[model samples]
Target: PEIKSWIDTVLYDSACDSQPLKDKFRDQLGIALEASLNPRRKKTVTENLPKGMKKLTAYGNLVCNA
Candidate 1:
């Protein structure tokens, strides 16, 4: 929800640009990761393909690459 909220804020704010919104998101993500025990790896792998498999896979790949 945080991600979606941030996206909406950025999308609706005419005076704001991507870099600022991205920086905010990065800060939030860092905080979240730091709060977790193992920030580098997922706890479990999904056995079955999720709904919207193509989009889900693409998003996972993008995160891994990033």
Candidate 2:
């Protein structure tokens, strides 16, 4: 969870780190989020989470907080 939070913060603040690290982390997040939408969670691949959040609940919470 701490890792996820760190990644999220890093991704959100692109100017704070190397572009390669941000890009890699963003791509990894996309892959994980894509895998997460695989259907076991009663959610379709077409489910619309937020722009960057990976988990559905996190997606909801992030968007709500935004």
Candidate 3:
């Protein structure tokens, strides 16, 4: 459960079973927890459409720019 907590809060501190400076990778990249390496989001997928349409919208109707 600790690992899950770390991931949920965007927390990471070094690596497990790894030397402090064996590869000096923390600065180059970043601390990667096992939980973050594998995250799964559960949600439903929906394709909104008109009452009777055989084509998909080319772009979203809610003007993103304005």
In order, the Cα lDDT scores of the candidates are 0.39, 0.41, 0.36
Model 3 residue pairs with clashes:
none
Cα lDDT tens digits, model 2, 21-47, are 556656765312212222333532334
The candidates, ranked best first by TM-score, are: 2, 1, 3
Q: How do these models rank on lDDT, best leading?
A: 2, 1, 3
Which runs of model 3 end up more than 4 angstroms from their true locations? 1-16, 21-23, 33-66
Q: Name the candidate that leads on lDDT.
A: 2
Candidate scoring better on TM-score of 2 and 3: 2
What does candidate 1's lDDT look like per residue over 1-66, in tens digits? 456443432223333435665566657653211121232444333445455433223224421212
TM-score of each: 0.20, 0.23, 0.16
Q: For residues 1-66, what per-residue lDDT tens digits would candidate 3 score against the true structure?
A: 344433322334334535554234344344442222212233222346344544432342222212
List candidate 2 segments past 4 Å from native.
1-16, 31-66
lDDT of 3: 0.36
Reference-based lDDT, residue 39, model 1: 26
In model 1, the number of clashes is: 0
Clashing pairs in 2: none
lDDT, residue 57, model 2: 45
